[model samples]
Target chain A: MLILNVILVIFLIICAVAVERTKDLLGAVIIFAAYSLIMAVLWLMLQAPDIALTEAAIGAGVTTILFIGVISRTRRMEK
Target chain B: MDDIIVKTITRLIVPFIQVYGIFVILHGHISPGGGFSGGAVLGSSMILFTLSFGLPMASRKIPHKVTSILETSGILWYIIIGLAGIYLGGKFLVNKEAGFFMGQAGELISAGIIPLLTLGIGIKVASTMITLFHTIIEED
Candidate 1:
C-alpha cells in the first residue's frame, strides 16, 4: 500500500512538472488531465471518495474539454 | 472530429455515460457522489457528443433557450422546495420537521429533502456547464 502511494505521488509530481514545462498547450492540458486522474485516485486512497469523484469529473473530464476548447480558439503552442 | 472511429466510439459510449450520471445524481443521498459531480459527468457526456458530432447538432440537441429555461427552473425548484419547509411551520430548508417523507435508512427514497435538493442542484449544474461550454465554443 505504501509503495503504491509513493508511486502515485511520484507520478503526480512528474505530471505537474511536465504540464508546466511543455510548450504545447494541448499536451499540457492532457498532462494536467493525467495529473487530475492521479489526484483522484489518491483522494480515494485517502478515504475521500466524494472529493475523488468530483476531482475526476471536473478535473479530468470537464476541465480537459474546456482547455481543449480554449486551445482550439487560441494558439496551440505557448509562445 | 471527422474520424469514423471516434464518432462510432462516442455514439456507443455517450448513453452509458449519461446513465451513469443519472445514477450518480439519483443515488447521491446514499452514495459518495452528489449533484455537482454527477452533473459534471452528465455535462461532459454532452460535451463528448459536441466534440464528435458538430456543435450545430449538439446545439440542436440542447438549444440555448432550453438551457436557459432549465437553469431558471432548477433554481426555482430548489426555492420552492425550501418554501415548502417554511409553509410547514418550520425554519428554512427544514427536512423532517417540514413533513418530508423519510423512508428507511440506506434505501433509495430515504433522506427527507436531501434527494430533492440534490436533483435541483444536479439540474442547475448540468445546465450551467453546458451553457458555459457552448458560450465559450461559440464565441469565435
Candidate 2:
C-alpha cells in the first residue's frame, strides 16, 4: 500500500506538471480532470469514502464540464 | 455531439445514473454518503445530459427561474427545519429530541430531520450545478 501511495503521488506530480506545461487548453483541462480523479482514488485508499466521493463528483465531474464549456466558448490553443 | 454513438449511450445510461443518484441521496443517513456527495452525483447526471445533448435541450428540463427558486427553497427548507427545533423548545437544528420520529437506527426513516435536511441540500446542490453550467455556456 505504501508503494502504491508513493506511485500515485509521483503520478499526481507528473500530472500537475503536464497540466501546466501543456500548450493546448483542452489538453490541460483534460489532464486537470485526470488529476482530480487520481486525487479521489488516493482519498479512497486512505479510507475517506465521503471525501473521495465528493472529489470525484465535483473535481472530476462538474469542474470538468465547466472547463469544457469554457474551452468551447473561448480559445482552445494558448499562444 | 453529432456522433450517433455518444447520443445513444447518453440516452440509455442517463436514467440509470439518475436512479443511482437518488439512491445515494435517499440512503444518505444510513450510509457513508450525505447531501453534498449525493447532490453532486445527481448534478453530474444533468451535466452529462447537457454534455451530450447541448444546453438548450437541458434547459427545458430545468430552466433558469426554476433552478433559482429551487436553490433558495432548499436553503429555506433547511432553515425551516431548524426553526422547527427552536419552536419545539430546543436549540437550532436539534434532532430526535424535537418530537421527530426516531425509528430504529440503520433504517431508511430512522434519523430525525437528517434525511429531510439531506433532501434540501441535494436539491440545492443539483440546481446550483445546473445554473452554474448554464451561466458559463449562455451567450451574451
Candidate 3:
C-alpha cells in the first residue's frame, strides 16, 4: 500500500506538471482529469470511499466535461 | 466524436451505471455511498450519453424543462419530508422517533427518512449536473 501510494503521488505530480506545461487546452484538461482520477484513487486508499466517489464524479467527470465544453467554445490552443 | 465503438459501448454501459447509482443511493445509510456520490454517478452517465450521442439526442431523453422541474422537486421533496416531522409532533427531519418504520438495522428499507432524503438529493444533484453541462455548452 505504501509503494502504491508513492507511485500514485509521483503520477499525480507528473500529471499536474503536464497540465501546467501543456500548450493545448484540451490536452491540459485531459491531464487534469487524469490527476483527479488519481486523487480519487488516493482517497480510496485512505479508506474515505465517500470522498473518493465525490472526487471521481465532480473532478474527473463533471469538471472534465465542463472544461472540454469551454475549450470547444473558446480556444483550443493557448495564445 | 461519433465513433461506432464509443456509441455502442456507451449504450451498453449507461444502464448499468444508472442502476449502480440508484443502488448506492438506496443503500446509503447502510453503505459507503450516499445521495451525493450516487447522484454524481447517475449524472456522469447522462453526461457520457451526451458526449457519445451528441446534445440533440441526449436532450430528447431529458429536456431542459424536465431537468428544471427535477431540480426544483428535489428541494421540495426535502422540505416536505421535514414538514412531516412537524406534523408528527417533532422537530424538522426527525426520523425513527416520529413513528417511521425503522426496519432491521441493515435491511434495505430501514432508516426511515434517510432513504427519502437521499432520493431527493440524488435527483437534485443529477439534474444540477445536467443543467450545468447544458448551460456551459449553450451559446455564449
* Candidate number achieving the greatest DockQ relative to the actual structure: 2
Tens digits of per-residue lDDT, candidate 1, B13-64, equal: 9999999999999999898999998999898889889888988999999999
Quote model 2's TM-score. Answer: 0.94
Sorted into a CAPRI-style docking class, model 2 comes out as high
Q: In model 3, how large is the Cα lDDT of residue A65? A: 87
lDDT, model 3, position A63:
92
**Backbone clash numbers for all candidates listed:** 0, 0, 0
TM-score for each prediction?
A: 0.94, 0.94, 0.92
List the pairs of residues colliding in candidate 2.
none
lDDT of 2 by residue, A1-79 (tens): 8999999999999999999999999999999999999999999999999899999999998998898888898899999
How large an RMSD does model 3 have?
A: 1.7
For the candidates in turn, chain A alone yields TM-scores of 0.98, 0.94, 0.96
TM-score of chain B of each: 0.96, 0.96, 0.96
Error of 1 at B107 (Å): 0.6
Q: Where does candidate 1 stray beyond 4 Å?
A: none
As a whole number from 0 to 100, the lDDT of residue B12 in candidate 1 is 98
Error of 3 at A69 (Å): 0.3
